[model samples]
Target: AGGISEALITTAAGLSVAIPSLMFYRFFRRRVDELVLNMEEESLKLVEVIHGEREPDRTSEAA
Candidate 1:
C-alpha cells in the first residue's frame, strides 16, 4: 500500500513539472521559428541589394 502511494505521489509531481516545461519549450520554439523567418527575409533583401537585382525606390530616398 505504501509503495503504491509513493508511486502515485511521484507520478503527480513529475507531471506537474513536465507539463509546464513542455509548454514553455513549445512557446520558445515558435518564437525561434518566427525569428528565423525574419532573418531569412532580411538576408534575401541584402543579397538582392548586393546583386543589384532590386532597385532602391526614389521616393523612399527622398524621404
Candidate 2:
C-alpha cells in the first residue's frame, strides 16, 4: 500500500513538471513556425523584386 502511494506521488510530481514544459515547448514551436513562414514570405518577395528588375520580360513567366 505504501509503495503504491509513493509511486502515485512520484507520478503526480512528474506530471506537474511535464505538463507545463510540454505547453511551453508547443508555444515556442508555434512561434518559430510563424517566424519561419514570415521570413520565407519576405525572402520570396525580395527574390521576385530582384528577378523582376533583372528581367522585365520574364515577369509574366513568374506567374
Please report the candidate that would top lDDT against the real structure: 1
TM-score, prediction 2: 0.79
- Candidate 2, residue 31: Cα displacement in angstroms equals 0.1
For the record, the alpha-carbon RMSD of candidate 1 to the native fold, in angstroms, is 3.1
> If scored against the real structure, what TM-score would every candidate get?
0.85, 0.79
The deviation in Å at residue 53 for candidate 2 is: 5.9
Q: Write the per-residue lDDT of candidate 1 for residues 1-63, one digit (tens) a residue.
A: 999999999999999999999999999999999999999987897788789998654563554
Candidate RMSDs in Å, in order, are: 3.1, 6.3
Question: Could you tell me which residue pairs clash in candidate 2?
Answer: none
Stretches > 4 Å off in candidate 1: 56-63
Name the regions of candidate 2 deviating beyond 4 angstroms: 53-63
